[model samples]
Target: MALPIVAMTLSSCGRAPELRVNDAVVILSPVDSNPAALYFTIHGGPEKVYLNSVLSRSVIRSEVHESKVDPKTGMVTMEPTRKIEIPAKGTVEFKRGGKHVMLWGVNRPARQLKELEAEFIFSNGDRIIVDAEVRAATAGDADKKDAHSGH
Candidate 1:
């Protein structure tokens, strides 16, 4: 009599190797706009990740911006931030009313926003490059709400 072999496949839910992003979108601001913001959602990780900086040819300068609200004054302002942390096995969002990328001093008039590319520099020496699409400035609210809800 031949014995039947039993085989089992185990599924693993182990955390992803490192940090990553999803639903990444950049709303290209109109030409001549200064200090435009970029929003997106970052996912994945077994350890914490930080956003180091952002780079693009569309602007003269790039910086990380964090939005803070004054409880007493009921005012909001964006200021340069050191690093935005992404928790382990978790996610981080760059959204309006929160954190975002500030691109300043757009030099040329973006006709139809022909070339919009952004390089996301991560603290772990990882780079995620994304091409942003041209969108109307008025659509910021919709984009912000969608980003806040985790894209």
Candidate 2:
């Protein structure tokens, strides 16, 4: 009917929220060669998109990772992720106990600057560069440490 067509048209259209990254930060490890986690949020655009990669000129190694706790065992685990999907007009967050970027071997320059500049690449061919403030390790860092040490 006419009403159905109108609904379809409305559904097909969306107002992209400028497709940005915000509140980026890198939680630095006190020990050298230890891993760091990058957290941020991605505001969605006009269409569904995939976060392909998170790159850093400040660190030699980085990847998208997610943490999960087993319901039966109550054991937490971390795993590398390929791509993260962001729905249109929606938001995806990279936060502790959730999706985040794990980085290693942060060079002295980034530490001196107290920030890490990361590149967020998307499936829609949109790339966003964000400066994540570097901060000292906190209690939330224990999970990453446990996972790394196999403790």
Candidate 3:
């Protein structure tokens, strides 16, 4: 009896939950050779999921990264991250000095359009397309200590 009930419950929620991506922005590097940063928010739905990756044809390279504080050096370090786990009914923010995406070589079209349509892929094989505002990097963004200038 319990086995049957469990099977029914699982079957009832077979589909992926309603995940949403918002507040996406891609700031182009002022130097043109440096990679740009992408920040966004992922709102979880009824079930947990993993953010597999972010893709965009507008950029030459795209990757997910995170910032961590090194205990020994007492400094901040940025590294590449394969995936990010989003809790059920929770939210994950990709911002500066934290988990964020890096886009390299903003193409002419993307720069001209001033936006990048980024595809957020999930573990459940769902893809959410979002228009991320693109802006020119400022002098403050070139600060290497913050690691936003290049990485």
Candidate 4:
């Protein structure tokens, strides 16, 4: 009985942190555009996680951002966020009109290619790489449809 208990403990200790991104996408912009937004769902691991930053070869810089709406003004604004915390066994979603990754100074090739690789860096030194699909800004209907469907 003691041996079995010890084995279980060891198994639990060996569990590594896991991060997963679902339905990752980048919104397409014009040829000389300097800014774009990336959206996805980040599934957390067994431990609490912090999203430090986003990296992409297609962009000169990337930052995390959250959308805020003013009640009186009835206007929506995007604000820069330093980091995002995801609860253990939970998920953080970056969606349209919500939290998202902002990419600045995007290159022409990235816009034409319609595909790019994004890397998510975590406070725990864990990195997750994902391929993001590019879609036109006019595809709001399709984006909404995909958001509602289960990934």
lDDT against the true structure, per candidate, is 0.66, 0.85, 0.87, 0.78
lDDT of 3 by residue, 33-83 (tens): 889899999999888899999999898889999988899998888889889
Q: Estimated TM-score per prediction?
A: 0.74, 0.82, 0.83, 0.76
Query: Against the true structure, what is every candidate's RMSD?
Result: 5.6, 5.5, 6.2, 5.9
- Two-way TM-score contest, 3 vs 4, winner: 3
lDDT of 2 by residue, 32-76 (tens): 768888889998887899999999988888989888888998877
Query: Candidate 2, overall lDDT?
Result: 0.85
Instruction: Return the top candidate by lDDT.
Output: 3
Best by TM-score: 3
lDDT of 4 by residue, 28-137 (tens): 54334546779999989989989999899989988898877789987777788899998887989998778988887766676678888899999899999998987666
lDDT of 1 by residue, 1-151 (tens): 2333322222334435667665555554544453566777888577777888888877788788777778998767667888888777787888778888776654455435544678888788889887765444565454553222221
Off by over 4 Å in 3: 1-17, 140-145
Name the 10 consecutive residues with the lowest summed lDDT in model 2: 142-151
Indicate the residue-level lDDT of 31 in model 2.
Answer: 71
Candidate 2 accuracy as TM-score: 0.82
Indicate the residue-level lDDT of 102 in model 4.
Answer: 80
For model 1, the superposed segments whose C-alpha errors exceed 4 Å read 1-9, 13-18, 28-31, 106-115, 139-151
